[model samples]
Target chain A: MSNGAVILQNISKSYKTVKALTEINVSIAKGELFGFIGPDGAGKTTLFRILTTLLNPDSGTATVEGFDTVKNYKSIRNIAGYMPGRFSLYQDLTVEENLSFFASIYNTTIEENYHLIADIYKHIEPFKHRKAGKLSGGMKQKLALSCALIHKPEVLFLDEPTTGVDAVSRMEFWEMLKKLRSQGITILVSTPYMDEAALCDRVALMQNGHVMTIDTPNAIINAFPVKIYAVRSNRMFHLLNDLQSIPETEAVYRFGDVVHYLSHSKTFDPLSITRHLDSLSHTEITVNQSVPTIEDSFMLYMRKSDKFNISQHDN
Target chain B: MTTERPKVIEVKHLVKKFGNFVANDNLTFDVKQGEIFGFLGANGAGKTTAIKILCGLQSPTSGEIKVAGFDVYRQTNLIKRNIGYMSQKFSLYEDLSVSQNFEFYGGIYGLSRKQIKERTSYFLEKLELTNEANKILKEIPLGWKQKLAFSVAILHHPKIVFLDEPTGGVDPVTRRQFWEMIYEAANEGITIFVTTHYMDEAEYCERVSIMVDGRIEALDTPAMLKQQYGASSMNEVFLRLARAQSAEQ
Candidate 1:
């Protein structure tokens, strides 16, 4: 983690008895477009809060830009921009007002760093006078990014920045991130969108308060240890249920209009599965093998890691 | 979905102003009957403001707008009864049970008791939420809540249903299922007026209009928009457009 702008070692946080983070270890490289990919309550927000110095980790040590997360909270906050998962911008303030307010809080003015946020700021400048609450999803996102970049932070933590934003704005926001990263700002974004996992230079896969894997998106997808298939038919509901009940099925779940399943019995035949279901009055049966995605990898790891955790506990 | 579909929603020279700032500027568009029309824009581009005007929630500074054969300013109540709306927040009472929320929304829409009962069961069965009807709204998962909200919005059989970022934080699997439900709704001849930030979701719309600086920068089918912007995905088109728009300023 010597090259890292943010580092965490065995950081754990819990709310009462419910553990939100469990001994997490990770390092985010400087000027890297890193992503935290996980589901809700997977402790992504918790981990981010600790790194951004918004919330203290219950245990272990963390650092941002070589500054201890606890000992140098102000120093870290000064250099790191954080866009929370929720819509945290001042709703009453107009777009420009929110930007100026955030810049003021960080002891800067929009003009001082206008070049840093110009790409995003220009989009919201016309609405600079429009109340934040009245702005649309995409507008709010641009304004948030503008505020986050006003101080010219060395690192940026975008907690699902694309969430609640329109498809077009979501895309544009990532591009802005790329441009900012080119300026040597380390960016760490978290998103529940699997397709977006491809946008990051690297990602940490999280589930159930634990880190499953962290690597390049391509490498993670390549490491998927099973043959993935998208089994589909006209009777999607029936096909999903029957696929789940198959004896050879290791894991069967509905993904979109298709049933995505991994085979425990490697010799399991799609024809037989389709035939067996077709015989049971399934309609328009169609089954074909498909490539594995990050979502599939996450599910596979979730299952294997659940067993691994139990085994480790037994020891 | 409508073979002989008339323009259900028409907006010509639509302009909405909040104080002196122009939110929507000389907007023009038409939503055909049964078409899934996507209102797309970067944040603060005024998609929601335009939507609010069309939905009769906010008054437009000036424009010729007709929804469901009624003028937006002169006959808003008639338009309200003929259309359904789902906000980004997804209007649902957390304390109310799932079924109770359905009843509440349905009653608010003026559905008779018999209609509410029949529609509730049908919707619950369709979404597989019948098993969780007794559960409180907050207890149900976000994905289920989204599905239930879509269900309740259409329970009265509105001619058009407006969905604002309906699948914001749900997982891919759930979001995909949610789109399937949208497809089913569109198949039922329901015009879907949706706003989304996801390129994949935007691709599902029959046509999408990209707004920047209170104007329609681009408006066409997803494929056409992508081709015009010389990008691989709708997301890329958005990035190029936003950057270009900002560079001009």
Candidate 2:
């Protein structure tokens, strides 16, 4: 109750025996761009639904903008905005109608908050008369965001906002998010794209209903404990398999065309590995040390959690 | 890879007009056999319209079109039989179980019931969805659902498979897994024509065509497209082409 924009304290939720969220504790500062990143079934949307007052956590307490989710749901709803993962807008309504409808529902007029959504609205202005169903994926995304911001909410929750959008649309959308963040809007966006984690001020990597790590993107990447190398050769598929079987190799998985591997050595010599691979007839070899990315850090974290689970099972 | 004369698909002066709006304006391209071709565009960029025509779903307003060694207009049924389609929404039934989804979709693709069962079991086992056979589709997580939908799309082992944003809403890992499945299909000599908003996914395709405002703005391999757009990534290539197209207009 310290006037934090969003607060989730030891929240727990389950559907029958399947635990969706477990002891989730997070506090988002006012006007911070926070990201919840993980694969599907990672409980990101669950946490979002809880904090936004759409669904109640079975235990513990959560608040948004100084209002309790359960006790002050009405107030929380009034101040917060949410764009669900699915396209939930009225398909029969025109783009303009959709915008106005959402604005009116929030007790505001589109005209009153035109400036807030003008940048996005301008793209879809000519298609204002078109039905929401007819809009393109990118335009639909813009319209959804504009509708979410029409009432000028202090906190916005976007669940995988760029999931199906084109790469260009994704870039544009993130740029829009950054602009909104500059205007003092607290954004909590959940995405499965690890690259997008860099765009946020800070991110919480979630998995299996738990927050694995929370830090700035750079901090997260910097915090990766292992030495990483990008390894590619003519025989990449077989090379990855071999690297996984190596004693020194911690993780070996395909990263784009090249296979990225982590060695359990701070002083892992690049040429020695190259020569070793060369002896195995892996030609056109390009083995170089590269900085750990968000994916690397995420993998490292997942591996640790998996090891812990395995040990616990044995015990 | 073949320098031979017989192209798998050849489109010349293709035009598809929906009322007054021209969906495809004099588009032309050649798709080689066993090529993982990408039909890429912004939403409303006419990529879907062109693909629909090629798949013999919609008759072009006026064009010379040939697919799978047949005319598009007259041999539409044959074309449909020869090709498979995974729409952006896909073709999975929400009420069906994982195995039922395969049976239904595979049956529609004209596979024998026995073949459907075998393919279903093999794919389910391959995808590690053996335990989820009885689970309803809507009950499964999105990543699993997406993969299953794709598996059903290629269930019949058609000569070609048209995928419309197959990895939408899926996690990165799922998307990667989906692409590997696509690559596996391609490796088996199935011509893949996929449309995706994810440029990273485009890199998996052997060749891609970028459509903007009812016309192809660029067509090349991912590396070539990136180099032509003078960008480091396929995402930037899309941005540059889209921007260039808008600026030209």
The DockQ leader among the candidates is 2
Which candidate tops TM-score? 2
Q: Model 1: runs farther than 4 Å from truth?
A: A1-5, A9-23, A39-42, A57-81, A86-155, A165-186, A193-196, A207-210, A225-315, B11-30, B60-64, B212-232, B236-244
Q: Write the per-residue lDDT of candidate 1 for residues A1-315, one digit (tens) a residue.
A: 676888899999998866788899999888899999975656789988999998998899998889999999989989989898888998998888888899899999989999998887887787778899998677777788788889999989889887665455566678888899899999999987777888999999876578889999999988877776777676654565677666787877755335776788767777777777777787777778878888778767756765213111110
Segments of candidate 2 deviating more than 4 angstroms? A1-3, A91-97, A125-134, A235-247, A265-267, A306-315, B1-6, B131-135, B138-141
Compose the digit string of candidate 2's lDDT tens values, residues A1-315: 476788888999998977889888888899899999987778988988888888898999998888899999999888888999999999999999999999999889989999999988999999999999988788899999998899999999999898866666687899999999999999999988888899999999887778888899999988888778888887754786666666577667666556777778777776766877887888899988888888777766766775212111110
Docking quality of model 2: it rates as: acceptable
- Candidate 1, pairs of clashing residues: A96-A128, A138-B43, A139-B43, A139-B44, A166-B196, A166-B197, A167-B196, A167-B197, A167-B198
Chain A of candidate 1 compared with the true chain A, TM-score? 0.91
User: Measured by TM-score, how close is model 2 to the native structure?
Assistant: 0.90
Worst 10 residues of 2 chain B by lDDT: B168-177
lDDT value, residue A88 of candidate 1: 93
lDDT of 1 by residue, B159-218 (tens): 899998887766555566677677788878899999886666776677888899899989
DockQ measured for candidate 2: 0.33
